[model samples]
Target chain A: MKIYIHTKFQESIYQQFRDGLEPKYEVIFGDGEVSESLKEQFLTCDICYGNVPLDWLNTSSQLKWLQLNSTGLDPYQQLTEYQFQLTNLKGFFGQSVAETTLAGILAVYRRIDELTRLQTKNEWVGTPIRETLHLLHKAKVVILGSGAIGLKTKQLLSGFECKTTVLNSKTISQLADYLPTTDILIATLPETKETIGLINKTYLDMLKPSALFVNVGRGSAVDESALIEILKEEKILGAVLDVTEIEPLPTESPLWNLPNVLLTQHSSGGWAEESAEKVVFFLNNLAHFEKGEELVNNVDLVKGY
Target chain B: MKIYIHTKFQESIYQQFRDGLEPKYEVIFGDGEVSESLKEQFLTCDICYGNVPLDWLNTSSQLKWLQLNSTGLDPYQQLTEYQFQLTNLKGFFGQSVAETTLAGILAVYRRIDELTRLQTKNEWVGTPIRETLHLLHKAKVVILGSGAIGLKTKQLLSGFECKTTVLNSKTISQLADYLPTTDILIATLPETKETIGLINKTYLDMLKPSALFVNVGRGSAVDESALIEILKEEKILGAVLDVTEIEPLPTESPLWNLPNVLLTQHSSGGWAEESAEKVVFFLNNLAHFEKGEELVNNVDLVKGY
Candidate 1:
């Protein structure tokens, strides 16, 4: 049998990955930049070592299993009955994303943006800031998604004596009546057939005026028009968004000009070390599946988690 | 016993205070602006209700206590004698100052000032921002003075999952190590002989590079010269200060132009409603003291807490 690595991986990781499957199969490297003539070698591979390309499934006829490293699996949600088990990298961004959620909440409460603007003008406009909303203690924070990243954010905020309630599509009664009194709303729902455009004007109206809204989840979950209307009408306290429907929010986008909005690059869970780590992790997991072991983070195509 | 409210107080509280104390002693009511002859009523009073400005003591030979509605006892520290017991309002500004510290740290970590400037000029800047330090779960924070205020700051950062440590003149082993590794340092010390110049170059050098610093303490607690020197060299990350050695920070001071500095006005803990709440709490305690009840926050001239 032959194994194909579609992307160039770290030298050390490549060696270890090769060593793991060497006794059973021959491993060869092929980057996306590899010539079409060289691509003919993929036909002989038993396992395809590549992320599902954005275009579509065009794996070689000899390819049996497709392994991935990124946590999100929506891109591969519609896999046909090829009998190939797809696995993905998960839990890698848990702590990283949770930290981002905490940072977003703190940014809104502290008025960091406003204060910094004043600093640039050489104005030391010291004024008493109220501590009434200082701690998340006794606050009702609502999270819309019960996935790994959402659970991690909950765990981080849980120790601060705050009440966290998550809303999932699974119809769990334990989480009902908990959404209305929320003091902060954090969205981590994956975009899918059921979740797209889930947050409407009526949905946002349920929040208290003191509530903070954060979206590290897909931008499709929130209706930009409703958000703009509610924010302009002062329905909520503020919002911190890491993802927008449009990547690289244009300078002309109305969302960029909102005073209460904190617009960040879509870097919700990324760090300097994450890219390299994910690449290495994927290669190792690819080796594990090749050994006929129970693979970690096997994606449930139907759930699209 | 007479109560002098130098500042405007709630009428409902004044009524409650008098009703609570009227049966035990003679109550004379006047504010700090009362005429000298009228204020001389303290001469016959056993306990004069007032804060600093020893005129009440001068008028009342029988004066046995001074109930102050302020938090810090610095103004009255050396200025007052043992002729009367002095009490102050404490724990009132804990949340306010804590919020200030959190705001400052978030401002630095997120590079808020630079982002706002970019927004003003309609420039996108997070690509450079992504290169700076982040507010992920691994932040280590140290707080000087684990008083009510410091504890509140800890509670806020606790939501961020920061590794929090604290230092006080007295022992706090319940907190993290005395001099532990910290990515953020928050100073909430009050103005006193022991606390003056508490933050110096050596204290600053112990902090992690690219760490955030916040000072909600008194102006004198920080060595301005040393702070300026460190900021000049960019050895530290960034700072937000509500207090400074010199008010207005002198237009000529280099701090006004520093890249990562935020100077706020000195009203960090005071709110529009705080003054009234302070008076009510103070008068309630004054009534309790008149009945020989142990004072709630009687100042210890020796400890200077």
Candidate 2:
């Protein structure tokens, strides 16, 4: 059986992935970018790791399984039909993303941004800055989605004694009620038909004036223009946006200059061992696949998760 | 019957303290300064709710109790004799200080410092910065002291799945064994005779090159010059210094301009309701004092905790 590896990992990570695979299988590696040669090679493989071009998968009759490197299935949601079994990196990113969310919230609450700025100037505004500092302890937090990321975030917040409310499709209707009292509003929803534009201007306006908005989910889940407008007007305290409406955030975007806003630039689900870990996850799932067993994190294309 | 309030709380906090006291008791509010008026009032008071001058307390024949607003009894450690029953605000700053320590550590681990700097320049070095990002999850941690601040720090670190070892005076001898493998080192010890200059050059040199040092304890607990030398040489990853040896640190201090050092300027024990909460603590302790009950957080001057 032939396997096509299409991941942009470092050389050592690729070597680790190659060493983990059974030596009997024929393997071809792509550098995560689609080319004429990659497309020809991808079509001949029975198994593929990493996200291959959807069009290539659509035409390939040999492809039996395709494992995605990403958790979000936004791009593949529109696919009506495919022969390959689709699995995503769902639970793997939970801890990393949750830690980043907590980092952003804590940085805001503890006045870390202000302190960092002060440190640059060698200014010590000691006693005066005290009153402006906040605490995550006993904060009222409302987290959107009940997926791995949201659940992990709730677990971390529990350690701080935060009163966290997890809202998903089932409890999303009550988000308006929670927003008025929420000290921190976090969105970790995937990009689905229902989730897109869910956090529009109306819901944004419902948030407490002192509430901190955090989005580690897909950018489409929120209305970026509405969020930007409210943030500009100081309708809400501030925001920690790991994912924004556009990648690179267009250098001219107001979010870059916004006083209280912290743009993590979609680096939340990252760590030193991110690629190596992903390779391991792929290899583990590949072992199960070779044994003709049901794979984990099989995405239901119709449900669009 | 006379109670002298010598705290630099806001007018509202002083009013809160006044309102909480019994109507029959005489109350005199001071601006937390040693003036002729305050000294005269301090000498006549039967009770005090702040850290008064040591000489004034020594000579005050009428003084009965002194409730210090500070958690550390650094100055009082030298007092050979006193008539008053002294109590410091121990355990009161646990949550606040712990949150700040976590905030600083998380800020470094998740690259909040780098992201914040990038946000200022409207620079989005997204994928490139991913390799530099780290996680607090599963890191080996070492915490100094077993007081409320240290215990609280450990409790918070548990949420990150960090393997935390707490070393008090009894367990401090084992610190050298842990430092070589520690990813994060936190000091929350008070300024006692035993704790002073505990984190010397030798101990700091034992830490891993990737270790992050955090100090929410008294600055005297660490040898500032040694810490500065190591940080300048990049012997350790970075440091979060909440309490430095000098207030407003010196204008020429390298700590202010150090690449990765986060100086919080001794504001860790602050929150929005800090002053108000202190007043409530003082009032509760006053009730105990009035009833001839053993006051909470009673400090032993000789032991210097």
Candidate 3:
């Protein structure tokens, strides 16, 4: 079977992936860009790993499976139908994403951002800054979406002894009540019909003035304009946005210059060995595919997980 | 009995402290400075709630007890003799200090410092920066000292699934064995005769090239010159120094301009309600003092914890 690997991995990682496959199977690697040659390779491959173009997959006849390197299925949601089996790296990112979420929140609470700024100027604020700092210990936290990321975030927050309440579709209605008392509000929701605009001005306004807002999930889940307004007015303490309304967040956007805003540029699900790990996951799934067993982390296209 | 609160508390916190005390006991609040009036008050008071001048305490015949606002007893180590029963806030800063240590470590691993720099420039460095990012998960960690800060730091690291080895004075000999394999090295040792300059060039040289060094304990515990050399040469990944050799670390210090070094400026143990909490602790300790009960966190100045 011919396999087209579409993920843009480092040279060493690509070599590792190539070495892991059996000698009998034909394999091709793409430069992670759509072109005539990539389309030709995609058309003949029996299995494809990584996010190949949605339009290319629509017309592909021989592709049996398409494994996504990412956990989010927002891009694939646009596809009306496809014959290929879809699997995503769902649980794989839970630990990494949750870690970044904690890092962001803790950075805010400990005033690491201000300290970093001071370090650059070689200024020593010293004991005076302490009065303005906060502790995550015993803080009341409200987390949105009970998915892997949210669950892992909650688990991590437990170490700080933060009282965490996770709100999902079932418990989302109670978010308003939790927000008023919450010291930290984390959103780990996926992009869905119900999730979009869920954190509107009303919910944002309900948060305590001392509340820290964090979003590690999809940006569509929040009303970005409303969040910006509240942040500008100092209605909420600050925000750690790993995901924003747009990728490569337009330089002109006020978020880049916001006083207490920390923009991670959606790099929360990243690690040094991310590409190599994804390759291993693909190889393991490939073994199950050869045995005619059901693939893991299969996504329901209609539900848009 | 008269109590002289030498701690520089906010006006509100001073009121809280005054309110908590019994009316029969005379109370005087100091402006946290050494003056003729403060010294006169210090000499007359039976109990002192903060770190009064060591010279003044030496001649104070009326002082019966000293409740320090800090965990470290380095300042009192110089006193040759004293009549007062000394107690420090040993376990009080454990939670706050541990949280800051995690925040600083995670900020480095997740590249929050670099991201913050990018944010300032309004630069969206997407995808490429992911390769430079790291995860604290499953990292081999070595923690120096077994004090409240060190133990609390270990407990917090458990949430990240880090394999942590805590080395106190007893197991400090084994530090060399752990350093070679350690991904993160944390020093939470206090300033004592034995602990001074413990993390010198020898132990620092043993660390892995990718190791991250964190010091939240005392500046005296580490050899600043050795740490600076390794960081300058890129022998190790980075460092998070909450306590430096000289703080308000002189303007000429290289630590301020170091690429990956995060200097928290000794603000790790601070919280919004720190002064209030200290007052509450003082009030509680006052009860024990009045009843002739063994005071909590009593420091052995000779041994210097």
Candidate 4:
């Protein structure tokens, strides 16, 4: 078997995985002109791993699995477009995304946005707003996507004295028990055919009126226009978005102007290597998979992990 | 026994605590403009419940004990200038202040400051930075002042899979076991004779260059001049200050202009009704103490807790 790795990571991560497969597998570095432009050049390889978007996948034949160095599947949602199996680096970032999700809740609940503005204006507005400050202890938290990231966030919030829950593709009745009571809606899901635009007005309506919403997963998971409407109407307290449907939310977009909204450029995941190790972990399993062995985090490409 | 309640939270909170404390305690509402001063109106009572600065009690002769409605003692530290039995509200705000401390840490760590600025400029930086996301797990966190607020923050951070540690007026060999390696420094001490200027240049020099510092207890606890020197020197990653020695940090102060600094007006503990309730609890407890019962949260003026 032959495998190729293309990403900016500590070589030790790749070496750790390769040592397990031994002489049965051959590894090659995919870094340069030939690797990116002409996928046909690597037709002999059995596995390839990188965070390349669908558009950059010049070819995918002979590639048994395409391991992504990220949790969300927005870049590879249309699996049919790719010739090989697609699996994401999901579990590796649960802690970071979970930490960021809690960070968002704290940002809004504590009025980080308002205070930051006041700092720049040199104005001191220190009145205690019971309505806002009380959110931390008694909030009903909703986590969309009950994956490792969502569950980890739930666990963290549970300790902060908040009521927490999650939403998934299938009405996992177990997860549903947690959502209706949600006062804070957190999106920590991967983008899929069923998840895109899941946060329409109807979904937003499920949240408590002053509920806080934070998105750290994929932008397409939310309907940006609906989110804007919700904030303008004061439907929910506000939203903190690290991910949005479009990158660099257009300058003209209402999201940039809403007082209740908080927009971040989706910088929640740890720097590159952290995500790379997650991907490599699954790839090393594939070598054993070729030799008839059980896999650790084998994502069923058809079902999507 | 008669008790003068000088705090605004005296009414409702007393009612709430009334059900929980011994009966026969009469509650007085003194959060108003009475022709009589705190000394004139409260001399008849055996105990006074208030945030009365020592200056206000200079003319009083019957103040056996004075219970404060705050964690810090700066307001009462100069009491030697007047004579009164004293106690302060120290543990009531553990949850709120701890949450605020965490909020400041998250804001600085996740760069909520940059996010707010980008909203106005319509920039999407979260996505590009996603590859470099920071996770708090195994992080080194240093919290100054292991009082109620710091203890509560350490508990909350403990659940996040991070390293936690504390520094106070004196080294606690027992607490040293719970302290993490110190990736971030969170200050939750009052501005008083001992704590003023505690986060001086010599103290900050003990931290990692990537460390972030957050202060929610008192502005003067941290030396603003030394902080400016550290920030200008880029000794740490960033800082978040809720209280400044001077309210509304001077616009001319370079601390306000630091790219990584976040200055919030002292609003962390200003959560209205709940805040009032906490104060009231102190008042009711003072009422109980006046009746010759043990006082709840009685501050030891000599120990400065």
For each candidate, the DockQ is 0.35, 0.82, 0.86, 0.51
lDDT of 1 by residue, B36-58 (tens): 66556656565655563654554
User: Which residue runs of candidate 3 sit more than 4 Å off their true CA positions?
Assistant: none
Task: Rate residue A181 of model 3 by lDDT.
Answer: 91
Candidate 4 per-residue C-alpha lDDT over B193-305 given as tens digits, one digit per residue, 9 for 90 to 100: 77777667766676667778788888887778888888889888788887788876677888777888877666677554565566567657655765778777666656655
Clashing pairs in 3: none
Q: List iRMS for all predictions.
A: 3.6, 0.8, 0.7, 2.6
Candidates ranked by DockQ: 3, 2, 4, 1
Give the top-scoring candidate (DockQ).
Answer: 3
1 against 4, candidate with superior lDDT: 4
Model 4 in CAPRI terms: which quality?
medium
How far residue A134's Cα lies from its native spot in candidate 4, in Å, is 3.5
Candidate 4 global lDDT: 0.69
Residue pairs with colliding backbones in model 2 are none
Per-residue lDDT of candidate 2, residues A1-305 (tens digit):
89998977788987897788778888888988889888999899998888877778768999899899899775777688887899999988999899999999989989999999888888889988889889898999999989999999998887788899999999899988888899999999988778889999999999888899999998888999999999999999899999998897999888899997998999999988899888888888888898899998898898775
The lDDT for every candidate, in the order shown, is 0.68, 0.89, 0.89, 0.69
* Candidate 4 segments exceeding 4 Å error: A1-37, A51-60, A74-86, A127-132, A167-181, A272-296, B1-48, B62-65, B80-85, B167-181, B191-194, B279-283, B286-291
Selected candidate, larger DockQ, 1 vs 2: 2
